[model samples]
Target: MPSPDRSSDAVTPFHLNVPEEELDDLRDRLSRTRWPERETVSGWKQGVPLDRARALVAYWEDGYDWRRCEAALNGIGQFTTTIDGLNLHFLHRRSPEPDALPIVITHGWPGSVVEFMKVIGPLTDPVAHGGKAEDAFHVVCPSLPGYGFSQRPKEGWPVPRIASAWIALMKRLGYARFVAQGGDWGSAVTTAIGASGDPAVAGIHLNMLVVRPTAEDLADATDQEKASLESLQRYMQDGNGYSQQQATRPQTLGYGLVDSPVGQAMWIYEKFREWSDCGGEPENALSRDEMLDDIMLYWLTGTGASSGRLYWESFRAFGSDKVMVPTGYSMFPKEIFRASRRWAERQYPNIIHWNELERGGHFAAFEQPELFVEEVRTAFRTLRTS
Candidate 1:
């Protein structure tokens, strides 16, 4: 429990115990949701299918359990520390392996720390999950300010600011040096941290590499680069409506999402379907309970507006700087945007590891925990020794 005083550096252990009344209210809201008529087009073209939405809501109201998620979070060891006047929440699990490397994994939009739950065990205790002792990590997964349990900012919390906070966080935890990994907004922050020339930041890795292709590069593009461009174009044309709305006018969009559990569920649910390797069925990649566990973080905290507001704050800041650290990247096929190795190497001049994975998607850890864990272990192994 962090003290009420603002800007305090006092780190406090935190436990999650959502009131029973809030659970009751969530069920009540789910029961009363007035769903719109089903989409005219087939198969998620219009949005989350009406039938799927109703089924998810029905399960959420009846079958889903928040207590399980809460207990899991507490079991993982939750904590809070006031950084820059915001009470930031994070999960810190120290490895039993003596020489474990400290690593912070950041999650992006439509996600919370819940994204890393499956991978945390494998990452923090590799021996327990069938990996080498050398692959073990002291894992820290933070709720990005204004996203999950972290305190919402009244104004100004762009990506760089978040990166600085993370640097400070690692230092506060007695990690004199560490590596970083992330996807989506997490990639941008990790890049910024690597770019900061902070000796404490040993290296970085990203599942989503953000790099702008030059016109010259496009003119002489390889087949893979051409495919990458096409995928990005499709996203810009069709899949980017949420970004435009959240980046420019999150407040207007937040009202409905904040007030309605169904709205928040669908908003995130659609992304899980479209972004994962699930092939239009999100449940194929993640269980209903897993999805609801994440959704509950937002619904329970009433952070629908605050979370979307991150795009408004830092949407345009991606790929703004080059990273000089020994960077690594694992490209999951279903990620929204991907850059070719050559293009990415130019931006990340000291790239140490680069692999284009055959399976997985935007939510790498959540959808394919084994693959994600392998990628991280492979990426940061040298850094751990160096």
Candidate 2:
């Protein structure tokens, strides 16, 4: 791929530095990765199909340049701070305008602040690019706890705890009443942050919101609702195994993931490729570098295990009280599944807007930045003024 553009527009403005010894160690590990034999199966029907992962690993070792990726990231502005004992990392780009709205963005598992790289420019300097100043925001994108540059917590850090830390981070940055947006795991954190009702939070926007079936919907659901429910059921059957494990026995899995980079890559790559809008092959929707960049962030940071712990923390606290802040939901077409407006309304009483999009998936900001920015901008536009 062409050298990454080093414009101020880049959202992730930080480069990772693996110690000389660490790089050598990683290389040694890659060289020593054990190959696993597999029974013949039809396409990814039996999970990642072993051969594909081997090919990716071969390319990763022989072709991929970590230094180049590190430079690409460092080209943007970045910083780190201690929050609630965990060191938090973030990308902060101030808007050119004198009065830009402060908006904080969070990323989910398998994603770092890197997901917002495409939209940082537009969100921070809209007026300079023919967009209205009102659409501009001083974007604050944080690598969720135990992910990216952030240090992993020894104790469990659940969604509510994360949300609390984010609220505190914004306060430290002097954003008393900022807007918040997230996707996937981010959606959960942002929702909890909104629910905190910390006057500093103006509104919440999300690309992924899992609304549990309500008593009424379950009683008299339409065919579409039934289909949606089935989709959810199927997801739980096939997809939720990861969540169950993380919630219950994250430490057990973390031991293996933290040791092997290939193992860590496979664990996350499978989710990105499977849970995305990609047509079977992830390369169809995302470039190899793009996929690897995310994986590299987790691997280099050694955050695979710590990040997985969020699943356990959040799932344990899922059935608490509802979040009562002004909320907005962006309905992406191929996000594994989406909750209907009615379903979302049941959980978030203050939902002010529900947007249906023509594109995007679970990784909305990365997959469809324009759509992601528009939905977020529109959702919070009214709240910002009021």
Candidate 3:
């Protein structure tokens, strides 16, 4: 059991026990899915393939086990706490090593605390995972507001506000000082945390960086920089429809997503195929169980609308502020927007570590857990002060 809530701003233990009725409702919904006709052309250019969607839903209804996912979450010690009037859910695992550094890992859209499940044990208990005691860390993985189990905000909650909430959350957990790490929107929140100039934030490490290059920075771009820019352009042209919808009119898109299980699954499954290191099929990068486990976070929470609202609230707000703390960046090859060190350094002046990895993509931790863990351990090894 988790420690009791100590004060008004107390942290409370949380458990997952979805009622059997909810599971039955999900099966019923999946059984009665109203899928559209097959795409005019073959392949994923049109979205999740019809046959693929049916196959996944078939497994989800019959073979997938929500209780197993619940057990895995409970095994890690889940907890919740009120911050600025919103209840936030998090996984808190303290290291056996007394002097381990404290770190907070945040997840982004189409993802939840599920992304960190594989990496948590290794981070908090390094010896058992083939690492020195010095490599251990006390890891905290928080569900973003409106994502997973966290309470959705009634009004707008931009990245800056989310960053403030994160800092407060760490302080509430008795971590006076800690490092922040993330990918996707997690990267945006971590950047804001570092930019807030909070002394409690020792440093930040990112697998995905949100950087907007200036005319000056772009004029003398190197070959790699040019390639990065081209990738961004391509994404803006072909891959930005979902972002545009989420940013401009999430409520309009939310009806279908919230009402249909297949709607929610394909919405996220498409990203898993597009953003992951998977060549064509998402299953190549993540197992069916892993993918559905994440999808369930959204489906169970009924947060399809709220989560999409994050983009509506802060899509254009990224790269508006510069992060000044000691920073580390791990650039995965297939990330939607890859920023070269030159582009990123212009925004993060004190960048201490920068590496271009051979594989992985937007969902770095979910796709390549071991590589992600190694990158995190190596990135923060130099930032630890105690």
Candidate 4:
């Protein structure tokens, strides 16, 4: 195994040091944004209303503090490395206990390294940081290949390729055996890591588990399963317009989104509302600034196009292989991942723990930090014993 890339020696520090001029430019552009008149549809029927988006934009332009969030992020140990010829950005914080297990946490699309921001201090320095030493971990949260600070891949890269790169990253960090955790696209990547059978990857914890629909399960499904299937069908129907567009014609859509912050926010906002169980208003569960923080990452980095390319890559690899690793699944009430335990077992016979949570939505880490952290901790505990 390669030695940890200690070329930097001490842990690296991070800062959200944007030029003052750039912030001024963003503010100017927001002020100059040309808006369209609203349609007659009520609620979210017509997507984000013009008035609502205007309110959000107003807050983003006047009230939000990017530096504050950046300072909070910089408080943690951040690092960057060239892996597979791409510049990779990650937050690497080690527990006080030298022997603590190393775990890599990956963030999904529309999510920067922001989701883990709330959990890092607690996970890495659990004792002085406020938790048990046993729950301590050396946490590494990487911005995906084509997202955030990480340099985008010239061409499309699939989950397996990304998983391989993560394995290489862990190896580079001097971790002979470590665990992986993620949700959404992060979940997909985590599954691929285990499925790759990398000996160094001790276990995998995923909030979004994907399994093939069995004939029997679909043929005579339970009322609950049927309800789930209907929900899935509806998502594929009403909610998957963006997915279809991304998978087929992301470049065509990218032209408009790249040029307009409002368009970009609408694209992400639609998913945040549709996929999450946010009780009528997405803003109720997620602060407007929090929403804009995520949206701005794509806008500033101009990653809206590359981030959408995951759908195209995923479509190519979907249903072609099965991941036979010791995997744990955390089922949130709002996600459309309604696979039965039997179905999941068939695909992943080494399934260790399958948790069904009563609260939280797709953004489990951000929405329910304590519960999500506990699930990951519990899953690793079981995996360690096995």
Q: lDDT values of the candidates?
A: 0.90, 0.79, 0.90, 0.78
Better of 3 and 4 by TM-score: 3
Off by over 4 Å in 3: 1-7
| lDDT over C-alpha atoms for residue 349 of model 2 | 84
Model 1 per-residue lDDT tens digits across residues 321-377: 889999999999999988888898788999999999999999999999999999999
Model 4, 270-358: lDDT tens digits are 77877676886887667887777788778877888888888878965643346676778889898856667777787677888888989
- Model 2: number of backbone collisions: 6
Error of 2 at 76 (Å): 2.6
Kindly list the per-residue Cα lDDT of model 3 for residues 1-386, writing each as its tens digit: 23334358878889888889999999999998887888888899888888899899999999999999999999999999988878889999999999888999999987899999999999999999998898889999999999988888998899899999999999988999899998888998999999998899999999988788889878999888899899999999999899999999999888988888889999999999999998987899999999999999999988899999999888898746788888999999999888877777778999988888898988988888888889888888887763
Clashing pairs in 3: none
Among all windows of 10 consecutive residues in model 4, the one with the lowest summed lDDT is: 1-10
Indicate the TM-score of model 3: 0.97
How many residue pairs of model 1 clash at the backbone? 0
Ranking by TM-score: 1, 3, 4, 2
User: To one decimal, what is the Cα RMSD in angstroms of model 3 from the true structure?
Assistant: 1.9
Query: By lDDT, is 2 or 4 better?
Result: 2
Q: In candidate 2, how many Å is residue 37 off?
A: 1.4
Candidate with better TM-score, 2 vs 4? 4
